[model samples]
Target: METIGKGGFCKVKEADVRVFRELLKKSTGERVEVTGMQHMAVKVFNRNVLKGQKTSEFDPFTGCLKMSDQLQSIMEEIKVWERNSNPNIVKIFKLYNDPTVPEMYLLMEKAQYGQIQIDLEGGDYLTKRNAEIEVVAVAKAGVHWPQGSGTDLEKASKWIFYQVAMAMEYLHSELKISHRDLKHQ
Candidate 1:
């Protein structure tokens, strides 16, 4: 697999065609061929970073006992993604756990435009301005928001803020959950 990105605790790779097919088959119980398919991003958590650590707590929302800090984080992320159907949030396709390995893989939709930080740094003036607008909108909404073009930043930012605020209100009031690490990225 070719490395596409990396973070402190995870590495994002361009999922290998063969491996992707195998994973899809395993996940869906159907043979899937990767022919002209959109590439999926595989986020592999570093085992070393999560080693020798565990946590157990009662989840107030799920009313179930959560175990292991790393495992809980992965499970919580998947749960949130599954519960939310917002267009602005990233979509998670599947979670792969190999018994032989300590690491876990998160199969997710690949963002075509890439990271916002890189875009802010290298993008044209308009792109940079739009990204800044998105950041401010997200902050105002207290959640994630989509970035786009061809509209006045003031009006577009307000709409983006409204959409994200509604989404967050739903997550908090209805789902009884919170995204503690909301950020521009």
Candidate 2:
């Protein structure tokens, strides 16, 4: 595994896992076996950061302050991701919790282009535009609607704005959650 990114409380690493595929029936009724290695991103949370923190923070969703701060935050994030089905959102494959381990692991889908923050820092104008386009494209790809073509920057900007607005609406109205820290990164 190789470290790809790191934040205050989490470190992201790139890893490959071998997965076995069962035999599948082909169109011609013949059995075919396939197996391959899948690339994934492992987000390891640093539990030490929450070691001495108070656990009595009030939770709006639960209407109670019963759970530990660390566990509450982790559970809330997992719940949000579990309820989210948006393609634009990074998918969480699995969560690992072990008694012996001090930290938790979240196995997630690897983004091909990487974080937008790094791309923007590279000073490429098209990188930001492409990132927005990619996000909008993924968000709208599942819907059955006629989407016009062309990579116009103005159009892309509008598309990105509208997509974000819709996502906010979904989170607020549908999921009853508010994202306080919203940023391009």
Candidate 1 lDDT, 97-146, residue by residue in tens: 66577778877777654554443433344233446645665566455444
Query: Best by TM-score, which number?
Result: 2
Residue range 70-123, candidate 2, lDDT tens digits: 655776778787787766566786676554667777777777657544544444
**TM-score for each predicted model, relative to the true structure:** 0.58, 0.62
Clashing pairs in 2: none
Stretch of 10 with least lDDT, candidate 2: 19-28
Off by over 4 Å in 2: 19-37, 54-68, 119-151
Clashing pairs in 1: none
Candidate 1: residue 22 lDDT (0-100): 79
How many Å off is the CA of 125 in candidate 1? Answer: 18
